[model samples]
Target chain A: EPEVTQTPSHQVTQMGQEVILRCVPISNHLYFYWYRQILGQKVEFLVSFYNNEISEKSEIFDDQFSVERPDGSNFTLKIRSTKLEDSAMYFCASSEAALNTEAFFGQGTRLTVV
Target chain B: AQTVTQSQPEMSVQEAETVTLSCTYDTSENNYYLFWYKQPPSRQMILVIRQEAYKQQNATENRFSVNFQKAAKSFSLKISDSQLGDTAMYFCALRGNFGNEKLTFGTGTRLTIIP
Candidate 1:
């Protein structure tokens, strides 16, 4: 089955530095999303992208975060400045249409800022 | 706002035994979707099963099944004939059918299947 794929399974960056995480969502799927999980916390929604624009974003996704569909298959998330608290597992998911359909997920990219 | 809750932090079951993980959600939307995702050690989130809010029947996939109570807003996952491979973190998620709606996920339940 086709699945979402994320690059740089793990990312380590210095505090105050910039980082860009890349993901290739399942082809033919329309809706794409990014979620993050702090160690033992719930998976929090960061942003949802569709029709070439961000549909919705959470309060956590402040000025530092931005998402781009750089290409037909590549969707990237960039953090302007990293902080220690920014360390977490970031997941990329995509659904064929949206609801009722299965949204496949990538393994995830573990981001660590020190 | 919608919230998904998983009360049990961790649960263990012997090999070949059965285990059930509890999940509860709060949502006023009439049409929505519920899903159970399994995250193994690799941290890959895989869909275990899904249930549509409009449907009254429970959803079952292989050894995985769900007990959904729409009225009570309770959705529980039951794993029959558990195996060591079944050990993983299970998350319950909810999403509305409306536009641009994102999924809300619970913290997760850590399930362990022992030998």
Candidate 2:
């Protein structure tokens, strides 16, 4: 089965530094999303992208966070300046359709900020 | 704002038995979707089952099924003939029917299938 693939399964970054997490969604998927799970916390939606632009975002997705679909296959999330609280597991997901459709999730990228 | 609640923090079930994880949500929207996702120790989330609000008939996928009470704002997951592999963190999520694509997830329930 085709799946969403995320690179750098684990990443350790310094506080105040920048980090980029990459994901290659399923080729035919039209909607892409970025979600984060803090240790012992619920999975929180950060942002959603469609048509190469942000469709919606949550309060957690502030100015420091940005998502881009640089190419047909690559979707990336960039954090301008990482903080200690940024340490969490970031998940990438994609769906063939937006409404009433199931979204497949990637293995997730674990970001640890020191 | 919408929120999902999973009251059970941890639950254990013997192998070959059945287990149910409870979930409740607060949503004013009439049309929406509910989902149950399983995250193993590996941390990859797998969709176990989904239920659309408009569908009165419960959604069942093999041994995995859900009892979604729209009026009560409750959606619970039932795993029948539970196996050791069913051990994982189960999360209940909610999504509105409009153009909103964001999913609000519950705190999660840790399920252990003991042999």
Q: Give the runs in model 1 whose Cα sits over 4 Å from its true position.
A: none
Clashing pairs in 1: none
> Scoring each candidate complex against the real one, what DockQ results?
0.78, 0.88
**TM-score of predicted structure 2:** 0.98
lDDT of each structure? 0.92, 0.95
In the range A17-110, model 1's lDDT, one tens digit per residue, is 9999999998999999999998878789999999999998999999999999988899999999999999999999998886668778888999
Q: Model 1, residue B5: what's the lDDT?
A: 94
Candidate 2: residue A66 Cα off by (Å): 0.6
Clash count per candidate: 0, 0
Question: Tens digit of lDDT per residue, candidate 2, span B46-72?
Answer: 999999999999999999999989989
lDDT by residue (tens digit), candidate 1, B30-67: 99999999999888898899999899999999999999
TM-score of chain A of each: 0.97, 0.98
For residue A44, model 2's alpha carbon misses the true position, in angstroms, by: 0.2
CA lDDT, candidate 2, residue B115: 96
Lowest summed lDDT across 10 adjacent residues in model 1 chain B is found at B95-104
